[model samples]
Target: MQDEPILKVVNLKKQYGPGCQWCSNGHESIFEKNRCLRCGTVYACNDLSFELYPGEILGVVGESGSGKSTMMKCLYFDEEVTSGAAYIGTYDDGETNVFQQSSQQKRHIRNTILGMVYQNPVLGLKMDFSSIGNIAEKMIAAGDRHVERMENRSKELLTHVHIPLARIKDEPKKFSGGMQQRVQIAKALSNQPPILLLDEVTTGLDLSVQASVLDLIKTIQQKFGISMIVVSHDLAVIRMLADRTIVMLDGKIIEQGLTDQILENPQHAYTQQLVYSLI
Candidate 1:
């Protein structure tokens, strides 16, 4: 384990507005007029803190509505953090003012310092662009504006993802689901980021495909020395990848421990239920 952390999320909170699917606010009893933005009611994920060390894999797990996705949004700074600080490095640098940063600053951070793999590969890719172009887009954002750098980086990334160099010119529509996701992985790594966030990266794939993608992720994490946060409901995936596991419920962390410890001796009742079902 590295002594320094690559990403630190501290006391983080996210709330969605009324009409949102994930809202955790009070039942529609009081009927306040000015609800939060987006969903329209408060989808509160309050006061969560977690860290990811270099070359370490931290898994976030829970049932639906457990705030796993909410927490991820906060980490990536997608939804404005209503409060608290999420530091990308030097966990104690006291840079708690993410909202105050300009849009350019946020873009630079998201582009150069972090890589994220979404649950859906297609939604994250450009339907009009070829595979190589999609990966090169990341290079452009990260300041590798020259065409040669973009081309070289794209080819290298596709190679890293085990995609044939010939397929790099093809549209995503031409690839299998697993191959498309591997492209997503390649694009995420285009900037050579030290931190990667995988949110349900294997969702909708068959067991064999899931295993292959999992293996690819493990290989990349080892090769790059990047810190990773794996968020998934798949317990088997968590067991295989996570150095430590955090289990959430109703927008709060209910349990955390070594993956083995929690799997073998779950403390919280809900955690026990999760474990038994895995049996």
Candidate 2:
């Protein structure tokens, strides 16, 4: 049906070192209680779970080391999942687990079904490639080979992200930080994936630049009607982009609800502190 969630995750966990006595018994909250006091294992994500509905923006916010990035990495398949399942409803009729898919299948999903914009532009863009080349790379991966069509689509996306068409032939090295980020956004959307994942995309930009990027993201979401999972440490950024928000601490979700509900009446102690601290 039209109401089904686009992405669903259940009991997702990622940890370093094998679980020992400390992980099994000593800590009540593995994420908050980072160290396995006895074994010293790091719990990057502990039973993290949530659902992303179609055409909705779901924000994941928390401090550094809160595992927000880890969760994103796992979903994008950049980091291997230690355990648990994540299902993309539009993938294989929603019956198959994404993490269990073969490497080739994972690559196909990453190229065709998912688009990601990383916090560091370096991670998302090939700095040496021209803006057009960058977007074309994604199209080629999705099986498009006609040069004319690729160039046209690249130009369309570059214009969509507000990058001037005149610089389409220039490499990312020639662009400013915010401009580079815009290029990455265009490339990620070149294939028009059903779901997009953004990891602290506006973190290092100037305040004015941040505002523009945020505006572009909102515009793109409205234009494409795509589902998005946004990870950020900035509540303001999340507030602007998310319909529903989830607050993560250590490695687990501490609170979740509509964006307005969470900001206006935060229930969790950490969430209250985080929300007020921003004020």
Candidate 3:
């Protein structure tokens, strides 16, 4: 791994409501999990900090309300963060904080620097558009104007993700869950982004399909050397793909280290419960 991080997120926070005196003063005793009992403010993500090294897969494991998805949304710009900064090494030499960028600049970053695959295929793919058309849409968003080139690129990416040539022009709504996820992967890769964010991409799939999707993700990482942050509640999934792991609970990261080390010797109680449950 490179010494310099490909992506760095510092003290990132996302909250749902205005804080009251008890929560605003940094009093943890009055809060219920991540919420202020007195004010009903939900701290969806609290002071999250992490880094993604070049060509490395960073796994973020947490339960349903653990803020993993919230953090992913903040990173992908799907939702605005309440505070904190993220620096992309490829963007402005890692000198600019992406959260502070203008809407146009954020769009540029989303289109060219980062690719996101949501847990829901509906969020990533245009269900009515042809699979190839969906890929082309991302390309066009990134300023690609050549029709033939976009078409070729779309075909190449779709094929790479195992989509049948015959179905390349079919709508994603017609595909199986696995196939839809594959199409979403193809669309995400159309811009050849250096950083990919996967938020529970394999959740709700059959075991065989989940394994196929996981294998494809590993293959993509190997082939493209992309740095990825994969968020999932499944420790088994994390063990298969991640080099390093971060364990989150109630909007905070309680433990993090090498995936193997964390699995073998989890330091936090919650992490231990998670690892032991997988046995």
Candidate order by decreasing lDDT: 3, 2, 1
TM-score winner, 2 or 3: 3
lDDT of each candidate versus the true structure: 0.80, 0.91, 0.96
Per-residue CA lDDT of model 1 for 122-175, tens digit only, reads 766885699999998888877787898789889988888889998889988888
Winner by lDDT between candidate 3 and candidate 2: 3
Off by over 4 Å in 1: 18-40, 90-96
Where is model 3 more than 4 Å wrong at Cα? Answer: none
Flag the better candidate by lDDT, 1 or 3.
3
Put down candidate 2 lDDT per residue, 119-222, tens digits, no spaces.
99999999999999999998998889999999999999999998899899999999999999999999999988999999999998999999999999999999
Model 3, span 193-270: residue lDDT tens: 999999999999999999999999999999999999999999999999999999999999999999999999999999
Ranked by TM-score, the better of candidates 1 and 2 is 2
Per-candidate RMSD, Å = 4.3, 1.6, 0.5
Provide the lDDT at 15 for model 3: 95
TM-scores of the candidates are 0.88, 0.97, 0.99
Angstrom error of the Cα, residue 134, model 1: value is 0.5
In candidate 1 the C-alpha lDDT for residue 227 amounts to: 83
TM-score of 2: 0.97
